[model samples]
Target: MSEWDAEFEVESESDEDPDFGPHGDARIDHAVASGTFTLDGQTFDVENNIWVVGDDAECVVIDAPHDVTEILEVIANRRVIAILCTHGHDDHVRYAPDLGLATDARVLLHPDDLPVWRLTHRAPPSGSLHDHQVIPIADVDLRVIHTPGHTPGSVCFYAEEFPGYPAGVVFTGDTLFEGGPGATGRSFSDHDQILESIRTKLLTLPDATVVKTGHGPDTTIGAERDNV
Candidate 1:
C-alpha cells in the first residue's frame, strides 16, 4: 500500500531513528512516497523517503516526492518553515511546489540542479541551497554539504548537535546509499566524482553519524565508510 500511484499509497508512518522518538529530543518523522521518476527520455517507478524535522510548533520537510497530502499529513498541524530538496531529481522535488503551495512555505534547492529541476518544474526554485549554509529548523540546524555526481548540485544536510538530540546525522540524497553510492550510470551523473564527494565530505564525519537517505532505509557513515 505504500506506493505512489494515482492511489497516492499511504504506508503506516515509521518512527524516527528509534532513539530519536517522535517525542524524543531528536524530533523527527519519516514516510515513504512512491511515483515514477522521469529523466533523459526514460522513466521508472521509485519510492522515496520523506524526512520531517521539527518540534511541536514548526518543522521542515525534506525531499517532497509523490504525495503532498501525505507530506502534509505527516506534518500534521505544525507550521511548515521550509521544503528542502536534497537534489533536483524529479522524484525528490516533484511534489515540492505542491507542498509549498499548500503550506505557504518556501522550497529550497541548490542552483546547480536547475537544469534537472526544470525538466519537471518550469518556475525556478523558491530559494537556493548552498555549501556550508546552515538551515535553521526548530532549534538544531542542517549544515549543507555539496556532494555532486548524482547531479551537479546534489547536497547533503548534516545535523551535528542540538540540545537533547544525538549528535552527527546527515541527509544524503542519491549521492550515497546503504551499500554504496547509487546509480551514476544515468545521464548527467558521474561515478568517480560521487565517490570522491562521499570520501571527502561524508566519510569524514563521526562514525556514528546517521545517514538519512532519499530512498529506502537509513544507514550510518561508519557502515558505509569501508564499503564505499
Candidate 2:
C-alpha cells in the first residue's frame, strides 16, 4: 500500500482529499524536511528541502510567496542555497528579494519571466534559468524544466533521491495539479502552451514522480493520471 494509508484518515479513494500532505510527503521523505509560510494574503506551504550531492549543504524553495516575514519564520534555521519560482506571479515573486537577502542564495528563474524579475529591481544571485538547464546548489542538482502555463517563465525543479520516491520528484508550481492542472489565464500565457507543457514536461516523468504544486495540495503523476 502507499504511504497514504499510514498518515491520513483517507476513507476511500472516492473521499475528497484536503491539504497536500499525503502526496507531498510521499515525494519528500520525512527526513527531507520542510517549512511553511503565508504570501499575498494567501498562505503558501513553502518547503525548504536540503539535498546531498555536493560539498556544501544546498536547499531549494518551491515558491517565493508574498509573505516574506512568514517565510523567513518558516526556514529561520536552515541554510538556504537556492530559490525556485514556480511561476512569475506577483504573489510568488514578492518575497524573492527579501528571501535572497536573508539567505544569500541564488535565485533561479526562466528567461521568459525576466520581466517579472526586473519589476523587483533585484538581480538574481546567478542569472536566467533555461529549459533543461541543470544547476548545482550547495549539494543539490536541480534540473529545470520550463513548464510555462501559468506564465511564460514558469518552471519546475526536479531532484532525484532527495525524497521518498527513489526515482525523484517534480515541483509543478502552477502548471500542474493533483486532479487536473492549473489554469492559464494571464494575458501572455497561451492555454495551448500550458497544456502542452504538462504533457511534455511534467507528465513525461516516471509514474512514481511526485508533484509538489504552488498552491492547494499535492499529487503524483500516477494518481493524477488515473483521474485524468
Candidate 3:
C-alpha cells in the first residue's frame, strides 16, 4: 500500500518498516445498528454506523445509533471518554444518552442542533461540542468541524496524525458521502449552505483522507473533491 493507505488497515508493523505513525497502535472498531429515524415529521428505517476510536484501554464512541447494547459490545469494557454526537438527527444520536449512561461517559453534541435533538430526547446532552474542539484518543486527535449543512448542528470529526493514515481520516456524520453531499431537502437544511460547507470545510482536506459516513460506504476526499 502507498503511504496514504486508504483501504485496509494494518494492525502491526511490516518487516520493511518498524515504526507506526503517532499512536499507530490505536484501533477503530465499526458496528451497525438498525432502527427508525424520525425528523421533520418523517420517519424512515435506517442503519447507523457506530465507530469506536482509541485503544483497548480507553476510547471514544462516535454516534450511538439505535442500540446501546451493540455499541457497548464494540466498546468491550474499554474506558469511554465520551459518546460523541456528530449530529442531533434521530438516526445518528438516538441512543447517545443510553450509551453514555451505560459507559459512565459524557454525551456531547453541538448546541445548535438542540431544537432537532429536543424533539426526540427529553434529557439534555451532558455537554456542548464546539467547532475546532479537540477530542483526544490515546495520542491521536478527533478535530471537530462545524459542518452545519446536514442540520443546524451537523459536524464532522477529522482524525489525523495517527498510524497508517498519514493523509488522515474524517467522520462525516451526514455531511458528505461517496456520490456527493448529504440530503438537505428537509427542514433546517439548506442546499446552498450544505454546498458551501462541503466546498469550504470538507473539500479542502487532503485528497487521500478517508470519508467515514453516518450511513452507506466510505470514500475518500480525492474521489469526492471533483464531484462536490
Candidate 4:
C-alpha cells in the first residue's frame, strides 16, 4: 500500500466520521471549517470547505478563507499542491498569502477576477485558471468550469466519479447556492450574466452532481436545476 493508503487505513479504522466522503479506492475527504469575522464593517459568516481529493500524500486546497489555521490543522501532514480561489472576493481570498506561505503551495485564480482580487490581496497568484482547465491530484482530476457572474472571473471546480464521490462534486464559489445564484449587487457583479452562467455551466451537469458552495449547506444539482 502507498503511504497515503497506509495512513488512511490506520486513520479510517479508528475514526468514525473520518472527514471523508463516498467510499472506495479513490477517497476524497472534506472538512467544512468556518469562521465569522467582520469585513468592511459587515459581519460575514464564512463557510470555507477545504477538500482533500487524492490518494497520494499530496493534495489540493480549494478556496482559502480567513481561518487558515483550522484548514492547515485539518490538512495535517499532507503536502498541499495548490490553493485555488473560486473568485476574487475578499472574504474568500483573505489569508491566502498566509496559507500559501505556510504550506508552500501555489496559489491560482482566474485572470478576470484579478482586479477584484487586488482589492484585498497585494501579491499575484502563482498561476491563472482558465475554462476547462484540468487540475490533476493523484488519481483525481478537478476540471475548472468558468461560471462568470458573481464576478467576471468566478469559477467552479468539477470532478467526475471521484473515488468516494460517485455523482461527482462541484466547488461553486459565489457563482451558485441552494436557493438561487450568487448575489450580483456588488460593483463587478452582473445578474443576467450570473443567471446565464448557472443555466449553461452548472444546470447542465447531472442531477445527482453535488453543489458545494462557498458558504451554507450543500445541495445537489437536481435540487437547484429547475429553479435556475
Q: Give the TM-scores of the predictions, in the order they appear.
A: 0.86, 0.68, 0.88, 0.83
Off by over 4 Å in 2: 1-57, 118-126, 137-140, 226-228
Residue pairs clashing in model 1 are 4-34
The reply for model 3, stretches above 4 Å from the true place, is 1-24
TM-score of 2: 0.68
Worst 10 residues of 3 by lDDT: 11-20
Arranged by TM-score with the best first, the candidates are: 3, 1, 4, 2
- Which 10-residue span in candidate 4 carries the lowest summed lDDT? 15-24
**Which is the leading candidate under TM-score?**
3
Model 4: lDDT to the true structure: 0.77
lDDT of 4 by residue, 46-111 (tens): 666666565547677788776777778767897787788898888788878889999988677888
lDDT measured at residue 192 in model 3 versus the true structure, 0 to 100 = 89
What would the per-residue lDDT of candidate 2 be over residues 72-180, giving only the tens digit for each residue?
5555565664666766665566667777878876565666887656654466424455666564444335577888766788888776655345667777777777777
Question: Candidate 3's error at 117, in angstroms?
Answer: 0.6
Writing each residue's lDDT as its tens digit, candidate 1 over 69-185 gives: 899899999888778889988999988998999998878788889998998899986777677766667667677899999999999988898553364788898988999997788
Count of backbone collisions in candidate 2: 1
